[model samples]
Target chain A: MAYQRKRICRFCEAGVQYIDYRDEKRVSRFLTERGKIIPRRVSGTCAKHQRMLSSAIKRARILSLLPFVSDNPA
Target chain B: MSELRNYEVTFIAEPNFDDERVNSLVGKYTEFIEKNGGTVEKVERMGKKRLAYAIEKRQYGYYIYTEVKMPGEAVAPLKRWFALSEDVFRHLAVRMTDRDVRLKAVTTEHYRKEMDRRNAATRPGAREGGFREGGREFREGGRPERRDD
Candidate 1:
């Protein structure tokens, strides 16, 4: 049998009960350089936390904490 | 009358608002909440912050976050007030559930512990041959290795 490592949800591991939209710094890490939300498969986020994260990102965008689209790719 | 509920209201004002102006603005909203059968619980002036994108061609905005307790009926009128007010550039009101309240109360200690655990786990050659650091190196070249074997 081949050995495989399990991926744990970072949010769950961190005991994050609420993902605050105001926390743009932490949320931005889950986004690609182009400002698109990274999918769960790529980011290893659980389904529930991914839903919360996406909504939080959307809310942050509305509040101008996160950009809807990046002007510069960098 | 409906029972009072917790709501979080956040608004952005023009970046040029001075401390005095911001305080007066907070006072104004506090009175507004009281008049609308609500009580203001907390107010935070987040100061001027650079916007992620231009809003009204402005690069910055002053943020105000407030927690209020009010009946559901009062929300509509408050939103209307925001819409009509020249001072408010943008506003959002979110109703808070018990879950939200519980989550908000989670302390920083939990986060610190998690970070420490992750740091320890990620130490060089700790486990799995430190695959995470190498994983990114592989990703930069091409898609990450996905084979289980």
Candidate 2:
């Protein structure tokens, strides 16, 4: 059987407007323990949003809203 | 010429500014990098999110990330720029080796999956009464419910 392809951007759901990095609860979902932004291919985020998401994650790290590295074990 | 290194610099802007102003500020940084003979690999705009803690009494901020390939000396000028910008609340510059770049790509994949798992766990009905072991509940009012049970 052929595999089904999934839509790239999950946040395309109507009414989802912006990526917020300060919300570790929300941003943590997009970052690895080492503090890297998960890519679109793996996160299924569309290219545009993934780019946005990565930027947000990076900002959060600098502000100490998120850690540069994960302290908790995965 | 000294070897070029990959560096990721991220910064948070005060949440109250209009989007246009934020973009302009970010553009300034891009321009600075280009003027310094650095190649900007990417620029990302992460939207507003709540701060982990209050910053200058503000609860949230706008975030921006930029990746650049430049000589090690460029970091000093970049740091100076960040220090001078009132809009920037915090910033960091991390040098990346070839190994670090490769590992970052792989780790990013793992991060995505982990996020998916958390999202799945949060969907309505994923758990009874929206509570999970060791997890706090966030009420619709935006306050977290303490797990007293």
Tell how far residue B111 is off in model 2, in angstroms: 5.1
DockQ score for candidate 2: 0.13
| Residues B40-130, model 1: lDDT tens digits | 9998888899998899899999999999999999999999988888888898898889788778668355667646644654564345576
Deviation (Å) of B100 in candidate 1: 1.1
Worst 10 residues of 1 chain A by lDDT: A1-10
- For model 1, residues A49-72, the per-residue Cα lDDT tens digits are 999899889989999998899979
Report residue B125 deviation for candidate 2 (angstroms).
16
Residue B48 lDDT in model 2?
Answer: 80
Strongest candidate by DockQ? 1
Q: Candidate 2's residue-wise lDDT over A1-74, tens digit each?
A: 56657654666542233554544676687777666677776667877667657776776665768766655635
Interface RMSD of every predicted model, in angstroms? 1.3, 10.1
Output DockQ, candidate 1: 0.47
Misplaced by over 4 Å in model 1 are: A1-6, B107-109, B112-149
Collision count for each candidate, in order: 0, 4
Indicate the fraction of true inter-chain contacts that candidate 1 also forms. 0.53
Clash pairs, model 2 backbone: A19-B47, A20-B48, A33-A70, A56-B46
